[model samples]
Target: MNNLFLRNQLCVPVKGYNRAIIYDILRKDYFLIPKEHCAILDTNDFIQFDKIEDVEEREELIDFLVNEEIIFQLSTSEQKKHFKSLNRNFENPNPLTNVIIHSNIDFRFLDLIKDQYLLNLSIISQEIDDNLLAILQKVSELEIDSIYLYIENSNIEKLDEYKKLFANYSLIFSVNFFNSKKIIDKTQLSQNIYYNFFEEEFSTYKRTLSIDKLAINAEHFLEAYNFHSYYFAKVYIDENGNIKNGLNNLENFGCIKSLTSSQFKEIISSSNFKELGTIKKKETLVCCDCEYRYMCVDSRVPSKGKKHWFHQFECVYNPYLSKWSNEEGYLNLEESGVYISASGCTIDQEKLSENFDKIWNT
Candidate 1:
């Protein structure tokens, strides 16, 4: 008997309450499949197609999988033995990889975490001043990979100065001047750097999820499987030098100035600080049943529950109904009978079952 196997890439089949998603890392895309189909893939071995329902529906599904290059046929057990699935486990050598600065304090405290070799540095400031230049000069000395500058209130008159400052630092690769009096064409800057001028205000706390934010790459999929893509190994320092996981995060570990090298490391390594990053989407309510769980990066702070976490804000997309909030014929998750509370999430199984065929059979 012939056997079916997923293609060379590590294709992960995740089952939701209503549907399932196949994350094709190689193609950088995903396919929505029925929960039953996901269960079939969950077997994760040389599949005997003949052993399935053997109906027209099953044949069509198998054909789709083959034609899309998601799966291939192997004639013999000997041939199957040579095929191996890739390991999806992720590991990072650095304890901290990214730093976000929202203040103009003496950032010299960065020396405490410099040993890990920071990959990215973000600075959020109100204006372009000598303080900004000083910070840029100091950071340019470090072996930092890249710097992202976000100025909330920008002065158009300083573009030439900004260009000169950026040219001085090779690591300052991206810059965004928000609330600019006049919009500047992006092409006005050097090709090596990404500089944009926006007349509208940009808030760090106001976040919204959309299909455009979904990253279908292998690195993101593997990391999202085990950790929070935004908060993991990332630190945010507010204007007063207070450190937190995110800008909106209320809990502050402590001010950077007051902390010693040992204390700083202890704080980051402690469960209290690391717990937020451990909250993977697969372990959260509503998000647990999302087809885009691993691919979508939703970093909004969540309310803690006994077993699972609840989103403090409503998600724009409903995985149960497979519809966006803005689209017509879209019913909110609550209308579908899934309730999120302090304890966790509770679902109306009967309602889910009744709607199953209506959704899939369409």
Candidate 2:
């Protein structure tokens, strides 16, 4: 109980944030060095309990890490119990993963519902036939556990209808909208819908979902095995009915319409399918060390040659430099010495003044 031992965890320096992000790979837990903490005992070196400073601050951090299972007290029995549960899960990996199919064709949703899988119907249009009809049909015919419908701001009108329709199996509706818009009161709408305004062009600092909290809430992390973030382990049925491993991914397994269960096994059994599905953040460039890696929903296919293996222009932080970069277009002092316009554009002052003049005149 006196000695503390570091687990087989990797503490790597993040490229964009300059903070060391710890990956408890065996347990699949991730953590950023807490800002208030003064030190992270050089975990790269096996932490010797006696050698540590033993200050209240240091002890507090040590206690926190021990509890997190990143490192554990040698005599602690809880860590071993946690490890056993995680190892069992890792060994008997859940083959079924949720597929998010964005389709213009409504009937195609029927084909993907045969399994007791979580299906996210990212319906392109808001003003379509009620999702409840599809959900009700699926519930009656097939054995599905959960069904989600992603809609736009325009679909607010159909909310009441959705509530009555999906009342049975908890069919949720996720939307991209603003709170200020006040299309519907959340207290009432939450009965059948969930709002995800994460993609809204809204803020300075964005937030990623919490992996640990997700595990706590969902019982298991739905994203624990998700690697590429695109349709990696899951399936993506395109608008053209071509079944690909991911959206916008060219590697088509085959058309969904003609795919039998036998053909489905063969498609997913190929090396290419399995290879793309396992490309984790640890294998990615800047993201390899990012604390947000495991929690993030990164579309790896977009960032192949770019600076980061996720999205480059979308990223505001440089982990190696540890400085949050400026607006996407406006050049920084380190990059270019020239001053930028007030609008955050890298344009000359004369045009900026002209824009100001037009605004004032109007």
Model 1, runs deviating above 4 Å = 51-56, 103-105, 127-133, 151-200, 349-362
lDDT of 1 by residue, 1-362 (tens): 24545454467788876689888887898898988787777655765555567578878888898887777877655676677776778898777888888637666686777666888888887788788888888777677889988888876787777787678778988888777646646434574787876555767323667675689888889889889887888888888888899766888899888888888888888888988888888778888888888898786898888888888678888887777777765666677667888787778978865664455566
**List of clashing residue pairs for candidate 1:** 103-239
* Model 2 pairs in collision: 15-319, 15-320, 16-318, 16-319, 16-320, 17-319, 18-319
In model 2, the Cα lDDT at residue 64 comes to 75
Backbone clashes for every candidate come to 1, 7
Residues 1-362, model 2: lDDT tens digits: 45546554333222222355554444555566743231344444446545445577567767777777666555663454443222212332534455655435446446545553444434332433555345445544644444555443345556556556446545445443332254434334456555443223222111222231222111222343335544455766666777676544677768767766656656766776666666666656555535455445544353443333343243343333333354233323224322222223233446544533443356
Q: Tell me how many residue pairs clash in candidate 1.
A: 1
- Runs off by more than 4 Å, candidate 2: 1-17, 21-31, 34-47, 54-57, 63-96, 102-125, 155-161, 169-180, 183-189, 197-226, 248-253, 258-261, 302-317, 321-362
Candidate 2 lDDT for residue 99? 60
